[model samples]
Target: MNTVQLERMKNDKGFIAALDQSGGSTPKALANYGIAQDAYKDEAEMFQLVHEMRTRIMKSTAFTKEKILAAILFENTMDLKVDGQYSADYLWETKGIVPILKVDKGLADLENGVQLMKPIPNLETLLARAQERHIFGTKMRSVIKEVNEAGIKAIVKQQFEIAKVIIAAGFVPIIEPEVDIHTVNKQAAEDILKKELIEQLKSLTPDQKVMFKLTIPEVDSFYEVLADHPNVVRVVALSGGYSREEANSKLSRNRKLIASFSRALTEGLNANQSDAEFDQMIGQSIQSIYEASIQP
Candidate 1:
């Protein structure tokens, strides 16, 4: 791992920007940004349009290292450019924000009440490309819809199993096992998950380090133990499905867990806004999220 990036990630005060919406989620992400399905006719055009939107965000003066510790990028975006530079390189070199690639193919069909990541057969090749671009780390996600201890264990286990490979490849891994916010027994599931994660952390060697991107727990700071774990670099909260205001409110309560929000972070942005309007909007979003990320 790059020691400068590692040091920044270990003690950075700002939140991560999740700009990694994938193939399955792109339509929804575009729709939320005021682009309809009819706006782009095919996958190629759709990706092109979304890339434009991302370029706008990245090139904005508002998007900088002071308020953004890092950004999680899609594979498509990783291969593309921003203002004449590779997306990852632009983020780190020009803006001082670490760039991370989302490496999971997608989620598998639910089994045992959980959704594991689809196989990433090309992860080794992907990591090599990322390394060449000065990328710092990788993130992969799976989901838990309800409380099933066996299923939850499977999710965490899968995350770590892949994380070890990522570690060996010399990159940090941000393992995200998202718990559905709508689950009636969400707290119960988180409790079981907390225990399983502790067991996994205890098993790691001192040199191993990983970051976690998790849902804002039902109770404030419920994952403090995980946050404080020596093997962990930082603990970040996913907004899940909350509105931006609601996400920020909940995030402030967690204190230690910084934001790695997708929808919530880009809730009001639109492709139609003028440059001045766009910058102001993103600036406000960054400020709100930064405040919550560093909340005491």
Candidate 2:
């Protein structure tokens, strides 16, 4: 890990709003706003809608720099322009918000809930592109379905293995291992996750640090160990499909694990709203999430 870059990321810790919806998720989001299937038949046209969606979100610029430390963007967004300037540069220059890139492809089917990221043959090239765009970090995701000890170990090991590559490329890696909230053994799964994460961090070289975006655990302090670990730069929580209010409530119970929410952060926003209304909804969301992250 590059200590300088890792420390830079640690210094910017706060709520990270995730705008990294994939091709699969984009259609679902557009549909929620009453967008018809005929609205955009092709992938290229759909990408424009995604760009519009992000532009609409950016109208709430007043809240971006203050409440959000960074924005996690999809690959398509990395090269997008706003007012003739690149979106990443616009965010930093106009709103003081750092930009992070989501590097993983969508999930692959593994066992029931265990997920592996879809392979990205050009990951190194992607990281190089992110650097060129001045993005500050990168995030990738995996999932855990149940509390099988062996499965948890394998997941943690693989995440760290990828993190090594990310760190070597001079970017902070947000390693996400989402534990499905519906799992019956939620607490047990978190316990295993905590142990495995700590053991893996112990095995890493001293400078190899990674950020975490975990589901809010059943036990509030289940991740407290990593939150304080030297090899961990930051520990943030994923909303994991929770309602905004629900996510805020759960996240408030934990110290150090702040918000890095996706769905919950965009809840209640719709394409039909006027610019003022849209800004109001998103601004309110940033406020709620920001407050939850700093709760002591």
Candidate 3:
């Protein structure tokens, strides 16, 4: 662990930028960026296109440590280069942004009201490579779609279990058990998640410091306790399916929970826009999210 990066994570007042769209979400992500499916011939070409998009975003004058504290990367992206530097190195050295890797293989079929992450048999290899590349941490996600306690419990359990391995490999883990925003019983599910998360916190040792990326709760300040938990490094909110404006408005109400938006962060960006237009749009997003993140 780099002490400087760890300290920055604890004290930073900026939000994270999620650029880690994996194979499952890449097509939709590309389409949103105004690149159609037929534009790319195969997975390799598709990823190359997405990487270019990500590089453009990363290279933007607005996307620096001044607003973005960190960024998450997909496995393929970690191996790619940006401006002749490895992605993680460029993020840290040029932009002053900490680099995090997304490690899950993606979610399994819905089970017991949730979708758990599929097994990552290659996690050790990924973690080792990330560490070698000067990456700071890792992120993995699972989804909760209902009010089933057993299912929610399982989600939390699986996340924490994987988190331990990541920590032992000498990296902080952002454990994301995303509660689907459109679920009818959203508030009830969040209530149970809070309880389950609190219970899970008890299993960690003093040296273990994990982070959380959660959905903005229906009620304001609902997750303040978790944000302030001693066992946690920090708490962040995912955009889920909200537009940038809606997500920013909701995020400002949740003190101590910063934004880690993906789609919302890049909502107005398009491959067709001129460089000036692209920079202006992303700059506006960075400013809004930065302000909301520092809300007290």
Stretches of candidate 3 off by over 4 Å are none
Off by over 4 Å in 1: none
- Which digits, one per residue and each the tens of the lDDT, describe model 2 over residues 252-277? 99988799988888888888888788
- Candidates in order, TM-scores: namely 0.98, 0.94, 0.99
Put down candidate 1 lDDT per residue, 1-296, tens digits, no spaces: 88999999999789999999999999999998889999999999999999998989888999989999999999999989988899999999889999999999999999988999999997899899988888899999999997899999999999999999999999999999999999779999999989999999887899999999999999999988898999999999999999989999999998689999999888899888999999999999999999999987
Q: Give the residue spans of candidate 2 off by over 4 A.
A: 1-8
Cα-lDDT of candidate 1: 0.92
For model 2, the local distance difference test gives: 0.82
Query: For this target, which candidate reaches the highest lDDT against the unseen true structure?
Result: 3
Which sequence of candidate numbers ranks them by TM-score, best first? 3, 1, 2
User: How would you encode candidate 3's per-residue C-alpha lDDT over 1-296 as one tens digit per residue?
Assistant: 98898888989889999999999899999999999999999999999999999999999989989899999999899999999999999999999999999999999999999999999997898889998998899999999998999999999999999999999999999999999999888999999999999999999999999999999999998999998899899999999999989999999998789999999999989999999999999999899988888998
